[model samples]
Target: MSQQTSILILDDEPIVSKRLRPSLEKKGYEVETFTSSVDALARVRERKFNIVVTDLKMEGVDGMQFLTEVKSLYPDTEVIVITGFATMATAKESFSKGVFDFLAKPFKLGEITEVIAKAEEKINNS
Candidate 1:
Protein backbone atom coordinates (compact mmCIF):
# COMPACT_ATOMS: atom_id res chain seq x y z
CA MET A 1 0.00 0.00 0.00
CA SER A 2 1.09 3.57 -0.59
CA GLN A 3 1.93 5.90 2.27
CA GLN A 4 -0.74 8.19 3.71
CA THR A 5 -0.79 11.69 2.25
CA SER A 6 0.59 14.40 4.51
CA ILE A 7 -1.34 17.69 4.80
CA LEU A 8 -0.68 20.91 6.63
CA ILE A 9 -3.46 23.36 7.47
CA LEU A 10 -2.65 26.94 8.44
CA ASP A 11 -5.18 29.52 9.62
CA ASP A 12 -5.27 32.30 12.17
CA GLU A 13 -8.47 31.01 13.70
CA PRO A 14 -8.15 28.10 16.04
CA ILE A 15 -11.57 26.84 15.05
CA VAL A 16 -10.55 26.49 11.40
CA SER A 17 -7.75 24.08 12.22
CA LYS A 18 -9.86 22.42 14.91
CA ARG A 19 -12.69 21.77 12.48
CA LEU A 20 -10.54 20.55 9.61
CA ARG A 21 -8.17 18.23 11.45
CA PRO A 22 -10.63 15.50 12.33
CA SER A 23 -12.38 15.66 8.98
CA LEU A 24 -9.16 15.31 6.98
CA GLU A 25 -7.81 12.69 9.38
CA LYS A 26 -10.99 10.67 8.92
CA LYS A 27 -10.33 10.80 5.18
CA GLY A 28 -7.01 9.01 5.89
CA TYR A 29 -4.68 11.98 5.52
CA GLU A 30 -1.78 12.53 7.91
CA VAL A 31 -2.80 16.02 9.03
CA GLU A 32 -0.99 18.75 10.92
CA THR A 33 -2.70 22.03 11.81
CA PHE A 34 -1.46 25.41 12.97
CA THR A 35 -3.09 28.69 13.94
CA SER A 36 0.05 30.69 13.48
CA SER A 37 1.71 31.05 10.10
CA VAL A 38 5.13 31.35 11.71
CA ASP A 39 4.75 28.05 13.46
CA ALA A 40 3.37 26.46 10.34
CA LEU A 41 6.28 27.75 8.25
CA ALA A 42 8.70 26.28 10.72
CA ARG A 43 7.03 22.94 10.36
CA VAL A 44 6.99 23.25 6.58
CA ARG A 45 10.74 23.68 6.63
CA GLU A 46 11.16 20.55 8.68
CA ARG A 47 9.07 18.19 6.57
CA LYS A 48 7.60 17.95 3.09
CA PHE A 49 3.82 17.94 3.07
CA ASN A 50 1.92 16.62 0.08
CA ILE A 51 -0.71 19.30 0.43
CA VAL A 52 -1.28 22.54 2.31
CA VAL A 53 -4.61 24.25 3.01
CA THR A 54 -4.16 27.77 4.29
CA ASP A 55 -6.30 30.81 5.07
CA LEU A 56 -5.64 33.94 3.01
CA LYS A 57 -5.77 36.50 5.75
CA MET A 58 -3.73 36.04 8.92
CA GLU A 59 -1.91 38.06 11.56
CA GLY A 60 1.58 37.15 10.43
CA VAL A 61 2.79 35.87 7.07
CA ASP A 62 -0.42 36.09 5.08
CA GLY A 63 -1.48 33.24 2.87
CA MET A 64 -0.14 34.71 -0.38
CA GLN A 65 3.30 35.12 1.09
CA PHE A 66 3.16 31.73 2.72
CA LEU A 67 2.10 30.14 -0.54
CA THR A 68 5.06 31.72 -2.31
CA GLU A 69 7.41 30.53 0.36
CA VAL A 70 6.06 27.01 0.27
CA LYS A 71 6.25 26.82 -3.50
CA SER A 72 9.79 28.11 -3.47
CA LEU A 73 10.86 25.62 -0.83
CA TYR A 74 8.78 22.70 -2.02
CA PRO A 75 7.69 23.11 -5.61
CA ASP A 76 5.79 19.84 -5.72
CA THR A 77 3.63 20.61 -2.69
CA GLU A 78 0.06 21.26 -3.74
CA VAL A 79 -1.47 24.31 -2.08
CA ILE A 80 -5.15 25.07 -1.58
CA VAL A 81 -5.99 28.64 -0.61
CA ILE A 82 -9.04 29.31 1.56
CA THR A 83 -10.14 32.85 2.15
CA GLY A 84 -12.81 34.86 3.90
CA PHE A 85 -11.86 37.83 1.73
CA ALA A 86 -12.13 36.21 -1.64
CA THR A 87 -11.61 38.37 -4.70
CA MET A 88 -11.05 37.73 -8.35
CA ALA A 89 -7.61 39.30 -8.21
CA THR A 90 -6.55 37.23 -5.26
CA ALA A 91 -7.81 34.06 -6.87
CA LYS A 92 -5.99 34.95 -10.06
CA GLU A 93 -2.82 35.62 -8.16
CA SER A 94 -3.14 32.30 -6.36
CA PHE A 95 -3.41 30.49 -9.64
CA SER A 96 -0.45 32.36 -11.01
CA LYS A 97 1.54 31.30 -7.98
CA GLY A 98 0.77 27.59 -8.43
CA VAL A 99 -2.11 27.07 -6.02
CA PHE A 100 -3.96 23.85 -6.67
CA ASP A 101 -7.33 25.18 -5.51
CA PHE A 102 -8.91 28.29 -4.07
CA LEU A 103 -11.87 27.91 -1.69
CA ALA A 104 -13.96 30.65 -0.21
CA LYS A 105 -14.82 30.82 3.47
CA PRO A 106 -17.95 29.25 4.98
CA PHE A 107 -17.54 26.31 2.61
CA LYS A 108 -19.02 22.96 3.40
CA LEU A 109 -16.90 20.06 4.53
CA GLY A 110 -18.01 18.10 1.49
CA GLU A 111 -16.54 20.75 -0.79
CA ILE A 112 -13.17 20.46 0.88
CA THR A 113 -13.40 16.70 0.80
CA GLU A 114 -13.91 16.80 -2.94
CA VAL A 115 -10.92 19.04 -3.36
CA ILE A 116 -8.85 16.77 -1.15
CA ALA A 117 -9.86 13.82 -3.27
CA LYS A 118 -8.62 15.63 -6.36
CA ALA A 119 -5.36 16.48 -4.68
CA GLU A 120 -4.93 12.91 -3.57
CA GLU A 121 -5.45 11.73 -7.11
CA LYS A 122 -2.82 14.10 -8.40
CA ILE A 123 -0.34 13.05 -5.73
CA ASN A 124 -0.92 9.40 -6.46
CA ASN A 125 -0.52 9.90 -10.17
CA SER A 126 2.67 11.86 -9.66
Candidate 2:
Protein backbone atom coordinates (compact mmCIF):
# COMPACT_ATOMS: atom_id res chain seq x y z
CA MET A 1 0.00 0.00 0.00
CA SER A 2 1.10 3.55 -0.63
CA GLN A 3 1.93 5.95 2.15
CA GLN A 4 -0.12 8.62 0.44
CA THR A 5 -3.84 8.24 1.23
CA SER A 6 -6.79 10.08 -0.25
CA ILE A 7 -9.68 11.26 1.97
CA LEU A 8 -12.98 12.88 0.99
CA ILE A 9 -14.51 15.40 3.36
CA LEU A 10 -18.20 16.12 2.64
CA ASP A 11 -20.15 18.74 4.51
CA ASP A 12 -22.48 21.60 3.68
CA GLU A 13 -20.74 23.79 6.18
CA PRO A 14 -17.49 25.07 4.72
CA ILE A 15 -15.98 25.38 8.14
CA VAL A 16 -16.01 21.62 8.69
CA SER A 17 -13.91 21.03 5.64
CA LYS A 18 -11.85 24.14 6.19
CA ARG A 19 -10.81 23.03 9.63
CA LEU A 20 -10.33 19.38 8.63
CA ARG A 21 -8.50 19.83 5.33
CA PRO A 22 -5.40 21.55 6.64
CA SER A 23 -5.12 19.25 9.59
CA LEU A 24 -5.39 16.07 7.55
CA GLU A 25 -3.12 17.44 4.84
CA LYS A 26 -0.54 18.20 7.45
CA LYS A 27 -0.76 14.56 8.46
CA GLY A 28 0.16 13.67 4.85
CA TYR A 29 -3.31 12.85 3.55
CA GLU A 30 -4.55 13.95 0.15
CA VAL A 31 -7.82 15.60 1.08
CA GLU A 32 -10.75 16.87 -0.97
CA THR A 33 -13.65 18.87 0.42
CA PHE A 34 -17.16 18.99 -1.05
CA THR A 35 -19.84 21.45 0.05
CA SER A 36 -22.53 19.38 -1.56
CA SER A 37 -23.13 15.63 -1.59
CA VAL A 38 -24.17 15.77 -5.22
CA ASP A 39 -20.79 17.11 -6.21
CA ALA A 40 -19.10 14.73 -3.86
CA LEU A 41 -20.88 11.75 -5.37
CA ALA A 42 -19.64 12.75 -8.80
CA ARG A 43 -16.12 12.91 -7.49
CA VAL A 44 -16.51 9.59 -5.73
CA ARG A 45 -17.44 7.95 -8.99
CA GLU A 46 -14.40 9.41 -10.68
CA ARG A 47 -11.72 8.57 -8.13
CA LYS A 48 -11.17 6.07 -5.37
CA PHE A 49 -10.60 7.38 -1.87
CA ASN A 50 -9.21 5.58 1.16
CA ILE A 51 -11.86 7.07 3.41
CA VAL A 52 -14.83 9.45 3.32
CA VAL A 53 -15.71 11.76 6.22
CA THR A 54 -19.17 13.34 5.98
CA ASP A 55 -21.57 15.41 8.01
CA LEU A 56 -24.76 13.59 8.99
CA LYS A 57 -27.11 16.44 8.11
CA MET A 58 -27.08 18.58 4.99
CA GLU A 59 -29.41 20.74 2.91
CA GLY A 60 -30.07 18.47 -0.04
CA VAL A 61 -28.62 15.02 0.52
CA ASP A 62 -28.53 13.75 4.06
CA GLY A 63 -25.56 11.78 5.31
CA MET A 64 -27.40 8.46 5.45
CA GLN A 65 -28.22 8.67 1.76
CA PHE A 66 -24.68 9.70 0.96
CA LEU A 67 -23.37 6.86 3.07
CA THR A 68 -25.59 4.34 1.34
CA GLU A 69 -24.61 5.59 -2.11
CA VAL A 70 -20.93 5.57 -1.35
CA LYS A 71 -21.14 2.06 -0.02
CA SER A 72 -23.04 0.86 -3.03
CA LEU A 73 -20.64 2.39 -5.52
CA TYR A 74 -17.39 2.12 -3.61
CA PRO A 75 -17.54 -0.69 -1.14
CA ASP A 76 -13.90 -0.32 -0.25
CA THR A 77 -14.11 3.29 0.77
CA GLU A 78 -14.61 3.61 4.52
CA VAL A 79 -17.04 6.25 5.78
CA ILE A 80 -17.00 8.26 8.98
CA VAL A 81 -20.17 10.16 9.87
CA ILE A 82 -19.98 13.35 11.91
CA THR A 83 -22.96 15.17 13.32
CA GLY A 84 -24.00 17.62 16.03
CA PHE A 85 -27.14 15.60 16.63
CA ALA A 86 -25.90 12.36 18.05
CA THR A 87 -28.70 9.95 18.77
CA MET A 88 -28.87 6.27 19.59
CA ALA A 89 -30.92 5.55 16.52
CA THR A 90 -28.45 7.27 14.25
CA ALA A 91 -25.59 5.46 15.87
CA LYS A 92 -27.22 2.07 15.52
CA GLU A 93 -28.26 2.68 11.94
CA SER A 94 -24.86 3.94 10.86
CA PHE A 95 -23.09 0.98 12.39
CA SER A 96 -25.59 -1.44 10.92
CA LYS A 97 -24.88 0.07 7.52
CA GLY A 98 -21.18 -0.66 8.11
CA VAL A 99 -20.03 2.89 8.69
CA PHE A 100 -16.39 3.12 9.65
CA ASP A 101 -16.93 5.51 12.52
CA PHE A 102 -19.37 7.93 14.13
CA LEU A 103 -18.16 11.23 15.53
CA ALA A 104 -20.25 13.85 17.21
CA LYS A 105 -19.76 17.53 16.53
CA PRO A 106 -17.29 19.68 18.45
CA PHE A 107 -14.63 17.05 17.93
CA LYS A 108 -11.07 18.07 18.52
CA LEU A 109 -8.34 17.85 15.94
CA GLY A 110 -6.65 15.12 17.91
CA GLU A 111 -9.78 13.01 18.01
CA ILE A 112 -10.29 13.28 14.30
CA THR A 113 -6.65 12.51 13.62
CA GLU A 114 -6.86 9.37 15.69
CA VAL A 115 -10.01 8.19 13.94
CA ILE A 116 -8.58 8.81 10.50
CA ALA A 117 -5.38 7.10 11.41
CA LYS A 118 -7.30 4.09 12.66
CA ALA A 119 -9.42 3.95 9.54
CA GLU A 120 -6.39 4.30 7.33
CA GLU A 121 -4.70 1.48 9.14
CA LYS A 122 -7.73 -0.73 8.69
CA ILE A 123 -7.96 0.05 5.00
CA ASN A 124 -4.29 -0.57 4.45
CA ASN A 125 -4.52 -3.88 6.20
CA SER A 126 -7.54 -4.95 4.17
Candidate 3:
Protein backbone atom coordinates (compact mmCIF):
# COMPACT_ATOMS: atom_id res chain seq x y z
CA MET A 1 0.00 0.00 0.00
CA SER A 2 2.84 2.34 0.79
CA GLN A 3 4.33 1.71 -2.60
CA GLN A 4 1.05 2.69 -4.19
CA THR A 5 1.13 6.27 -2.93
CA SER A 6 4.29 8.36 -3.17
CA ILE A 7 4.47 11.80 -1.51
CA LEU A 8 7.16 14.40 -1.88
CA ILE A 9 7.45 17.24 0.66
CA LEU A 10 9.69 20.21 0.00
CA ASP A 11 10.59 22.97 2.45
CA ASP A 12 13.62 25.12 3.07
CA GLU A 13 13.65 24.17 6.74
CA PRO A 14 14.87 20.79 7.83
CA ILE A 15 12.54 20.73 10.81
CA VAL A 16 9.51 20.77 8.57
CA SER A 17 10.55 17.52 6.94
CA LYS A 18 11.64 16.06 10.24
CA ARG A 19 8.21 16.62 11.75
CA LEU A 20 6.24 15.54 8.69
CA ARG A 21 8.15 12.54 7.43
CA PRO A 22 7.57 10.30 10.41
CA SER A 23 3.91 11.14 10.78
CA LEU A 24 3.20 10.56 7.12
CA GLU A 25 5.29 7.39 6.93
CA LYS A 26 3.54 6.01 9.96
CA LYS A 27 0.31 6.19 8.05
CA GLY A 28 1.67 3.85 5.34
CA TYR A 29 2.67 6.55 2.96
CA GLU A 30 5.86 6.51 0.90
CA VAL A 31 7.23 9.82 2.10
CA GLU A 32 10.29 11.69 0.90
CA THR A 33 11.36 15.05 2.19
CA PHE A 34 13.89 17.58 0.97
CA THR A 35 15.05 20.95 2.23
CA SER A 36 16.28 22.12 -1.13
CA SER A 37 13.93 22.93 -3.95
CA VAL A 38 16.60 22.27 -6.55
CA ASP A 39 17.01 18.68 -5.40
CA ALA A 40 13.28 18.21 -5.04
CA LEU A 41 12.76 19.52 -8.55
CA ALA A 42 15.33 17.10 -9.86
CA ARG A 43 13.65 14.22 -8.10
CA VAL A 44 10.24 15.15 -9.49
CA ARG A 45 11.62 15.03 -13.01
CA GLU A 46 12.87 11.52 -12.45
CA ARG A 47 9.84 10.01 -10.78
CA LYS A 48 6.18 10.55 -10.07
CA PHE A 49 4.56 11.42 -6.76
CA ASN A 50 0.87 11.03 -6.15
CA ILE A 51 0.82 14.15 -4.01
CA VAL A 52 3.17 17.06 -3.58
CA VAL A 53 3.35 19.26 -0.44
CA THR A 54 5.51 22.30 -0.88
CA ASP A 55 6.36 25.63 0.74
CA LEU A 56 5.71 28.65 -1.41
CA LYS A 57 8.74 30.69 -0.42
CA MET A 58 12.10 29.15 -1.21
CA GLU A 59 15.47 30.20 -2.53
CA GLY A 60 15.32 28.46 -5.89
CA VAL A 61 12.40 27.05 -7.80
CA ASP A 62 9.71 28.44 -5.52
CA GLY A 63 6.45 26.63 -4.94
CA MET A 64 4.66 28.40 -7.79
CA GLN A 65 7.21 27.23 -10.33
CA PHE A 66 7.45 23.83 -8.77
CA LEU A 67 3.69 23.25 -8.81
CA THR A 68 3.47 24.51 -12.37
CA GLU A 69 6.09 22.03 -13.47
CA VAL A 70 4.43 19.21 -11.60
CA LYS A 71 1.04 19.95 -13.14
CA SER A 72 2.57 20.09 -16.59
CA LEU A 73 4.34 16.79 -16.07
CA TYR A 74 1.45 15.11 -14.33
CA PRO A 75 -1.80 16.95 -14.48
CA ASP A 76 -3.51 14.58 -12.12
CA THR A 77 -0.98 14.92 -9.37
CA GLU A 78 -2.57 16.80 -6.46
CA VAL A 79 -0.61 19.69 -5.01
CA ILE A 80 -1.08 21.22 -1.56
CA VAL A 81 0.74 24.43 -0.84
CA ILE A 82 1.89 25.26 2.71
CA THR A 83 3.68 28.42 3.60
CA GLY A 84 4.35 30.74 6.50
CA PHE A 85 3.49 33.66 4.29
CA ALA A 86 0.01 32.69 3.27
CA THR A 87 -2.26 35.34 1.86
CA MET A 88 -5.39 35.70 -0.22
CA ALA A 89 -3.37 36.46 -3.32
CA THR A 90 -1.20 33.40 -2.96
CA ALA A 91 -4.16 31.20 -2.30
CA LYS A 92 -5.92 32.52 -5.37
CA GLU A 93 -2.80 32.08 -7.43
CA SER A 94 -2.33 28.52 -6.31
CA PHE A 95 -5.88 27.64 -7.21
CA SER A 96 -5.47 29.29 -10.58
CA LYS A 97 -2.60 26.93 -11.25
CA GLY A 98 -4.68 23.89 -10.25
CA VAL A 99 -3.51 23.25 -6.72
CA PHE A 100 -5.53 20.83 -4.62
CA ASP A 101 -5.46 22.95 -1.45
CA PHE A 102 -3.69 25.73 0.40
CA LEU A 103 -2.66 25.62 4.05
CA ALA A 104 -0.94 28.14 6.20
CA LYS A 105 2.12 27.38 8.26
CA PRO A 106 1.79 25.86 11.77
CA PHE A 107 -1.13 23.77 10.71
CA LYS A 108 -2.17 20.79 12.77
CA LEU A 109 -0.85 17.45 11.58
CA GLY A 110 -4.34 16.11 11.33
CA GLU A 111 -5.24 18.89 8.94
CA ILE A 112 -2.69 17.75 6.45
CA THR A 113 -3.58 14.13 6.95
CA GLU A 114 -7.19 14.89 6.15
CA VAL A 115 -6.23 16.82 3.03
CA ILE A 116 -3.93 14.06 1.89
CA ALA A 117 -6.69 11.57 2.34
CA LYS A 118 -8.90 13.70 0.15
CA ALA A 119 -6.20 13.89 -2.46
CA GLU A 120 -5.79 10.14 -2.36
CA GLU A 121 -9.48 9.63 -2.89
CA LYS A 122 -9.39 11.96 -5.85
CA ILE A 123 -6.41 10.14 -7.26
CA ASN A 124 -8.08 6.78 -6.88
CA ASN A 125 -11.20 8.11 -8.51
CA SER A 126 -9.28 9.54 -11.44
Candidate 4:
Protein backbone atom coordinates (compact mmCIF):
# COMPACT_ATOMS: atom_id res chain seq x y z
CA MET A 1 0.00 0.00 0.00
CA SER A 2 1.13 3.54 -0.66
CA GLN A 3 2.11 5.58 2.38
CA GLN A 4 -0.14 8.52 3.22
CA THR A 5 1.23 12.00 2.71
CA SER A 6 1.91 13.64 6.06
CA ILE A 7 0.84 17.27 6.50
CA LEU A 8 1.40 19.76 9.29
CA ILE A 9 -0.86 22.81 9.58
CA LEU A 10 0.06 25.75 11.80
CA ASP A 11 -2.37 28.60 12.40
CA ASP A 12 -3.24 30.67 15.44
CA GLU A 13 -6.95 30.44 14.77
CA PRO A 14 -8.58 27.26 15.95
CA ILE A 15 -11.23 27.34 13.28
CA VAL A 16 -8.70 27.20 10.49
CA SER A 17 -7.15 24.01 11.82
CA LYS A 18 -10.56 22.54 12.61
CA ARG A 19 -11.75 23.12 9.10
CA LEU A 20 -8.65 22.01 7.25
CA ARG A 21 -7.70 18.84 9.11
CA PRO A 22 -10.62 16.77 8.00
CA SER A 23 -10.68 18.06 4.45
CA LEU A 24 -7.03 17.22 3.90
CA GLU A 25 -7.45 13.87 5.60
CA LYS A 26 -10.32 13.10 3.25
CA LYS A 27 -7.90 13.49 0.40
CA GLY A 28 -5.68 10.74 1.95
CA TYR A 29 -3.18 12.84 3.84
CA GLU A 30 -2.15 12.29 7.44
CA VAL A 31 -2.94 15.74 8.80
CA GLU A 32 -1.83 17.24 12.08
CA THR A 33 -3.07 20.74 13.00
CA PHE A 34 -1.56 23.18 15.50
CA THR A 35 -2.62 26.60 16.76
CA SER A 36 0.80 27.24 18.24
CA SER A 37 3.77 27.72 15.96
CA VAL A 38 6.17 26.93 18.78
CA ASP A 39 4.53 23.62 19.48
CA ALA A 40 4.39 22.89 15.78
CA LEU A 41 8.07 23.57 15.45
CA ALA A 42 8.75 21.16 18.28
CA ARG A 43 6.81 18.54 16.40
CA VAL A 44 8.65 19.35 13.21
CA ARG A 45 11.87 18.66 15.01
CA GLU A 46 10.55 15.30 16.02
CA ARG A 47 9.76 14.16 12.50
CA LYS A 48 9.61 15.41 8.96
CA PHE A 49 6.36 15.98 7.13
CA ASN A 50 5.65 15.97 3.44
CA ILE A 51 3.93 19.36 3.60
CA VAL A 52 3.39 22.25 6.01
CA VAL A 53 0.56 24.81 5.73
CA THR A 54 1.05 27.80 8.00
CA ASP A 55 -0.33 31.26 8.71
CA LEU A 56 2.06 34.20 8.43
CA LYS A 57 1.01 36.15 11.54
CA MET A 58 1.22 34.57 14.94
CA GLU A 59 1.98 35.62 18.49
CA GLY A 60 5.34 33.86 18.72
CA VAL A 61 7.56 32.41 16.05
CA ASP A 62 5.82 33.96 13.07
CA GLY A 63 5.52 32.20 9.73
CA MET A 64 8.55 33.78 8.14
CA GLN A 65 10.86 32.50 10.85
CA PHE A 66 9.16 29.15 10.82
CA LEU A 67 9.52 28.92 7.05
CA THR A 68 13.16 29.83 7.23
CA GLU A 69 13.85 27.28 9.93
CA VAL A 70 11.96 24.55 8.14
CA LYS A 71 13.64 25.12 4.81
CA SER A 72 17.00 25.13 6.48
CA LEU A 73 16.35 21.94 8.40
CA TYR A 74 14.21 20.05 5.94
CA PRO A 75 14.66 21.29 2.42
CA ASP A 76 12.48 18.55 0.99
CA THR A 77 9.44 19.49 3.05
CA GLU A 78 7.10 21.70 1.02
CA VAL A 79 5.61 24.72 2.79
CA ILE A 80 2.46 26.65 1.85
CA VAL A 81 2.03 30.05 3.46
CA ILE A 82 -1.46 31.39 4.18
CA THR A 83 -2.04 34.86 5.51
CA GLY A 84 -4.96 37.26 5.94
CA PHE A 85 -2.45 40.09 5.88
CA ALA A 86 -1.25 39.38 2.38
CA THR A 87 1.14 41.87 0.84
CA MET A 88 3.29 41.77 -2.26
CA ALA A 89 6.36 42.04 -0.08
CA THR A 90 5.32 39.09 2.06
CA ALA A 91 4.45 37.01 -0.97
CA LYS A 92 7.74 37.81 -2.62
CA GLU A 93 9.57 37.05 0.61
CA SER A 94 7.84 33.73 0.96
CA PHE A 95 8.72 32.72 -2.56
CA SER A 96 12.29 33.86 -2.12
CA LYS A 97 12.53 31.93 1.14
CA GLY A 98 11.42 28.72 -0.66
CA VAL A 99 7.74 28.18 0.08
CA PHE A 100 6.03 25.80 -2.30
CA ASP A 101 2.98 28.07 -2.50
CA PHE A 102 1.64 31.30 -0.99
CA LEU A 103 -2.07 31.61 -0.30
CA ALA A 104 -4.07 34.63 0.78
CA LYS A 105 -6.47 34.17 3.65
CA PRO A 106 -10.23 33.80 3.32
CA PHE A 107 -9.32 31.32 0.64
CA LYS A 108 -11.59 28.64 -0.71
CA LEU A 109 -11.04 25.02 0.24
CA GLY A 110 -10.68 24.20 -3.41
CA GLU A 111 -7.75 26.56 -3.73
CA ILE A 112 -5.91 24.93 -0.84
CA THR A 113 -6.65 21.46 -2.13
CA GLU A 114 -5.32 22.37 -5.54
CA VAL A 115 -2.10 23.65 -4.05
CA ILE A 116 -1.74 20.55 -1.94
CA ALA A 117 -2.27 18.43 -5.02
CA LYS A 118 0.62 20.18 -6.71
CA ALA A 119 2.81 19.76 -3.65
CA GLU A 120 1.91 16.11 -3.53
CA GLU A 121 2.97 15.72 -7.13
CA LYS A 122 6.33 17.23 -6.36
CA ILE A 123 6.79 14.98 -3.34
CA ASN A 124 6.00 11.94 -5.45
CA ASN A 125 8.23 12.98 -8.30
CA SER A 126 11.17 13.65 -6.04
lDDT of each: 0.93, 0.91, 0.93, 0.94
Ranking by TM-score: 4, 1, 3, 2
Worst 10 residues of 4 by lDDT: 19-28
Candidate 3, residues 5-86, lDDT tens digits: the string is 8899999999988888999999888999999899999999999999999999999789899999999999999999999999
* Sliding window of 10 residues with minimal summed lDDT for model 3: 1-10
| Backbone Cα, N, C clashes tallied per candidate | 0, 0, 0, 0
Question: What lDDT, from 0 to 1, does candidate 4 have?
Answer: 0.94
lDDT of 3 at 45: 97
* TM-score between candidate 3 and the true structure: 0.96
Judged by lDDT relative to the true structure, which candidate is superior, 1 or 2? Answer: 1
lDDT of 4 by residue, 1-126 (tens): 999999999999999989899898888899999999999999999999999999999999999999898898899999999999999999999999999999998999999999999999999999
Off by over 4 Å in 4: none
TM-score (all chains, Cα) for each model: 0.97, 0.95, 0.96, 0.98
Candidate 3 Cα outliers beyond 4 Å, as residue runs: 1-3
Candidate 3 structure lDDT: 0.93
Residue 124 C-alpha lDDT in model 3:
87
